[model samples]
Target: MTASKLYILDTNVLLHDPKCLYEFKEQDIAIPMTVLEELDDIKDRKKNVSSEARHAIRAIDHILSGASTSAQITKGVPIKQNALNGVDTRLGKLSIFPDHELTMRQGFLPNDHNKDNLIINCALHLQATNPHREIILVTKDINMRLKALGAGLLKVEDYRTDQLVSDIELLPAGHYQMEGNFWEHVTDVKSYQEGKYTFHQIDRSILPNTYPAEYIYDESDGFAARVISVDEETITLQDLNHERIMQQNCWGIEPINIQQAFAMQAVLDPSIDLAILNGAAGSGKTLVALACALEMVIEDKQFNKIIVTRSTPPVAEDIGFLPGTEEEKMTPWLSAIHDNLEAMHEQDERPQSSVKYAIEKANIQFKSLNFIRGRSIQDALVLIDEAQNLTPSQLKTIITRCGKGSKMICLGNLAQIDSNYLTPLTSGLTYIVERFKDYPGAANVHLEGIFRSELAEYAEEHL
Candidate 1:
């Protein structure tokens, strides 16, 4: 029989996903004393990290509480699969490794009191003592994993339990291109007309797993349509009336490309409550979102007001503390919002001061995401900028707060996530784009063309 491997987890692995303890089935799991210390320090932090830390500590405490004695915990306790609501079922032993003489014998530098190095020392001690079993250090920090391998630990890996995709390129762009001869494949179809749109029903077998609001285009024929309904037998598509809408100005701004036009249509539709726009740095994700929101709140009178929020992340180093109200502190992070509003005002041929006047009269609100809990926003256009920095849990909280008659628009560039724990594949923006793709009231667009400026586009491409 093959011996089970011993996996030593870092504090980041726990904070990234609190349920990671049960992911390693039938393998011995070790938690270093240094990791517990780190969790204790982080348990009181704000937002997702604190919630994850507290949940992880509680899970560990729950397991230890059922143990017969403290010595039983030291000797290793069996992690039953039935504990976590019966989702995981692997009989593995869990033990907390104390900082002992074995760790000191590893000969790490006495002055290197960093938590990462101390965790590596614990894994090294386990490898030295247990010759028959393999020991691996599982960490989410890339630099820590590299440091462990450089320190002569042969087994090291990243925690990938929460990653939805192995590569960012594999994520769906929410659209598909049909061949020039696409109409030749359709047979036994039903047709009808509603307003300016011509609806067609084709067999669902032709496009398996096709989702509502997904765009399909044929370049050669200059034909485009969006899936409106999906049934077990057939899918209904509505011909895109791009000519009229594409030429119409949205709040004095025009879409520069076909993708942007599609985004405008999705945002203007009152039936669709959720819209996501993702793109490169200069792809106008924020501009289109802000324009549509202003039009909805001011020109159309469809929504009561506009609420804007975004993640606050420093560029290089922490700026310590700012003295002011919540909105004053958020001004530094929301410069893009201010810039886009000013540009819209200029396009409307209004005086510069009118931007502030319009915002105040229209009841536009700038909110910090930190205080969004327990409040239901009704009949509002809620715009979440820089959404890539949010975790799935944070995104869920924001989405669930949308009350009746409210719509949400998420704008972000996946390449520019600033959160230390989030990545393109595991970000909250990506999560919603994938999960809500098939929902009838949700639509997504990936804008490609850069409309900010020639210099900005050049920098985005080359640098």
Candidate 2:
């Protein structure tokens, strides 16, 4: 019988997903000592990944806690079965490899004090010694995968346990567009009125892919409706007037397109707890979100305050050294929010005064993502900008901080992801959009077209 494959992990893989320890089902996992050393060096750093490194270390320690001897640890430790997460049987063993003591071979890549070379050397040594087992090296770094393969490792793979979609193109667009009259497809429909709103109960077959809170629009017939509820047999859609939605104004800002109108409608609705907006860089995501937030806080009195935070790049660690209050320090990262605010009030006779009045009236607060971990925000409208830079775990940490009577709006542009560890397919924005599609209290809109400028639109398409 063929033996189970031995999979080796890299440092970035653990930092990418700390819970990855149990994700590999029934396969033996080997972590080189270099990875531990790297994690040790990083666990004490002030970066956002330090917490992830510590979590990875704790998971490793938990798995190897029962071993009494170095010999037993070197050989392998039986992974404890976790039935809660669906690990029903003890079929995998985890071991640590001492890569520093690996003997050099004639064709092996020179270590030269490089950490990646050390990891590659360990894989080469393991492959040379264990001829029967198929060894695979898993890392999130593309360069590390190339180096491992170049050093003669048989199989190298990426850590894809958190990936929800194989391709970004397969992701849902948050709204459906029908070419003709939407009623043409409905064979059975029962229209009714409930509290100044019209709802249609149609056979489920008419819109099999529709989900709650997703919009269905027909440009030809100028009809739009939102899927309010769905059952196995029928779907209930709340009818919306296209012209009325387009004419809706929030803080003097009206929707430029139907997609933006959909976003504004979702954000303004008090029943929706979460709204995700994704589009090109200049697609008015930030503008629309901020406009709705201001209206909710200052005009409608729905929310008491507006809390804005975003995932800053790890390299910008000088936020602590910057001389100012928390809001001032966050000003650099949250400049986009201010820019949108200024744009909203640009036509005012006293633009700067209007901006200041708006800020004070709304009780707007800028916060750092690192500082928002433990606090629960109540009666607030939270706007998270540049969300594509975050991992799924990081996004979850912020989302859970929303207490009762608080709403969250996440705005991201997948084309401009700045995180080295993320791609459009693995982005947290993409993850949430897919995970929360069917949720009744959440809505997602992928705003189309760049309304920022004609030049910006041309660059988005051509450049």
lDDT tens digits, residue span 1-463, model 2: 2237999999988988988877777788999999999999999976667888998999899889989998888888877776336655775788999888887777678869899888888888888889989999998888989988887899999988888889898888888998788877788889999998899999998888889999999957478989999999999999988888899899999998999999999999888899999999799999999999999899899999999998877443454556789888788888898899899999999999999999999999998887999999999999999999888888999999999999999999999887777889888899899899889899999999998889999999998
- TM-scores of all predicted structures: 0.90, 0.95
Clashes of each: 0, 0
Candidate 1 structure quality by residue, lDDT tens digits, 271-334: 7899998999889888888888878888889999988888777778878777799888777888
Model 2 worst lDDT window (10 residues) = 314-323
C-alpha lDDT of candidate 1 relative to the true structure: 0.82
How does model 2 score by TM-score? Answer: 0.95
- The residue-level lDDT of candidate 2 at 258 comes to 95
Best by TM-score: 2
Which segments of model 1 are wrong by more than 4 Å? 1-3, 45-48, 67-69, 77-91, 100-103, 106-111, 181-188, 194-197, 205-209, 231-233, 347-350
